[model samples]
Target: MSAPLRLILFDVDGTLVDSQATIFAAMRAAFSAAGLETPTRPALLSGVGLSLPVLMKMLVPEADERTQDQLVTGYKEAYHDLRLTQGAAHSPLYPGARGLLEQLSETPDVLLGVATGKSKRGLDQLIEAHGLERMFVTRQVADHHPSKPHPSMIDTARSEIGASQGDTVMIGDTSFDMQMAEAAGVAGIGVTWGYHPRDALGSAQHMVEDFAQLAGVLNKFWTVDHE
Candidate 1:
């Protein structure tokens, strides 16, 4: 019989790429354009895994839906312009990201995927820039799904890839990701190098400090049935 498939889904912004600076810049510009007080760095980072419209609402709770929509548009415009001018390399992969991906890609029975709050265009640009277009078999973007803490992305990815919940894992930096994984009945792994604090990822089944430690954590899951 064929081995059970393992689907590893990753969050983009905080988990893989360190795009805080770029994101902060765009968010600041967007808020300014919308005539609102710019959110603090911590506030912006805290909202990393949420969709733009949801984030805008959280950042500016008093704003109406139309105003929130305008903020989302402004944020997208500013972010796109920043990428165009600074190039996609502005958001560099975290240390050991490529090595971890390379190792996972070479492992049999492993299939990679992404479930991120980034728009499809944004995710595509990041993937293409880092030559990771071939790494992820499934891509779930904010454009197509509700924000994190919702299981739609994970459910869809699992269904599309024909992977069982027991064999799927969601790796991300936020509580939202962990919550989503829990809601989807999959395992959730947290990385400490991302935006959210370690305490915030309490829902994760495992937490790793760096890429060197990630493989071992994942191996625990991979070898579970065999043991």
Candidate 2:
């Protein structure tokens, strides 16, 4: 008989790739182009798992809808321009991310997916740049679903992969990811080497200090049957 199918969904920004520099730069550029003051680094990083529009609004709630829209467009353009000029080399994956992903991908019962706030275009670019095109079976992005903490992305990924909630896990570095996993009725594993602090990931079912720990944790998570 075939092994039980397991779905592992990942969050892009703070989870897999450390894109803080690029994200902050784009946020600064967007705020500048909109003639608004830039938020501090911590403030910017705090919204890492949220969609661009939602993040912009959170950063500048006093701004009107038109201004929010302008900020969104500006952020996208700035981010795209940065990607073109600097390439994906600027957004490096955390230590052991590639190796762990490769190991998981080779596991017959494991199916990897991405549930991220990144747009499909951005996700595609990053995946291609990192030669990770074959890593994920399903790619859920902000353009197609509600932002993190809503469970829509995880829900969609599970559906596409035909994995039950108990057989699925969401790995990320933010409370948004943990909340989304809970909302989807799946397990959440939080990584501490990302943008959010360990305390922020209280909603996570398990927390790992680094990718090495994450790998071991995932091994157990997959091997053990979960209710």
Candidate 3:
């Protein structure tokens, strides 16, 4: 018999929400203030599905830990401050984020949680304002566990959903997500709607071009282990 899916861990920024413009704007501001090269929009995107510290270390590598700290502090403060009012304003949910969440919620056997690179505070605030808190059983953010490409966060979310490694799936838009799922020995699906382009999701087992395709894909993928 195939393993059954009991949990689905999703990435926050790129997968469920469209915060690219806000992220890019805040990143540019922080980089400029730190006297680092302001990343282009595309370059900024490379950070979306990854960890904050990882992104900071890559973009502002010339900085020492203290400088990196300042940049992070600045970035978070700016993003949080500006984003509170703009919550999903500058960034909207991808086409079917709400519908997908609702559909998944209706499944008594399926549990949902967010495994994202966002800070816990950031996730809480954003989810609350965006009306997404009810859809997830748990919210695992960047610093809450080791960042992506690491399975700790995924593992943690699975635990929250009462799912074992054999019965959970990871959904994201980047190689980091795919790598994490692969490392955890679970299935991973990469979505094209997120920051990483389709080509960037090299390690994913499945890929979808839009939100509408998600439900059908998931319904099928969810049962792959059951057969």
The C-alpha stretches of model 3 lying farther than 4 A from their native spots are 1-5
- Candidate 2, residue 104: CA error in Å? 0.6
lDDT of 3 by residue, 1-227 (tens): 64344888898788888888888888877877888778788777887766777888877677799878878877888798778767658567888889989989888778888888888888888887878878888788887777788898887777666687767888998888989999988889999888888897888988998888878888887556456
Number of clashes found in candidate 1 = 0
Could you tell me which residue pairs clash in candidate 2?
none
Error of 3 at 154 (Å): 1.0
Q: Candidate 1, residues 1-227: lDDT per residue as tens digits?
A: 98988899999998999999999999889989888989899999999999998899898899999989999999999999888887867699999999999899889999999999999999998898888988999999999998889999999999999999988999999999999999999999999999999999999989999988988888877777436
Model 3 C-alpha lDDT versus the unseen true structure? 0.82
How many pairs of residues collide in each model?
0, 0, 3
In model 3, which residue pairs have backbone atoms overlapping below 3 Å? 2-225, 2-227, 3-225
Task: In candidate 1, list every pair of residues with a backbone clash.
Answer: none
Task: Give the Cα lDDT of each candidate.
Answer: 0.92, 0.90, 0.82
Error of 2 at 47 (Å): 0.6
Give me the candidate number with maximum lDDT: 1
TM agreement with the true structure for every prediction:
0.97, 0.97, 0.93
Ranking 2 against 3 by TM-score, winner: 2
TM match of model 2 to true structure: 0.97
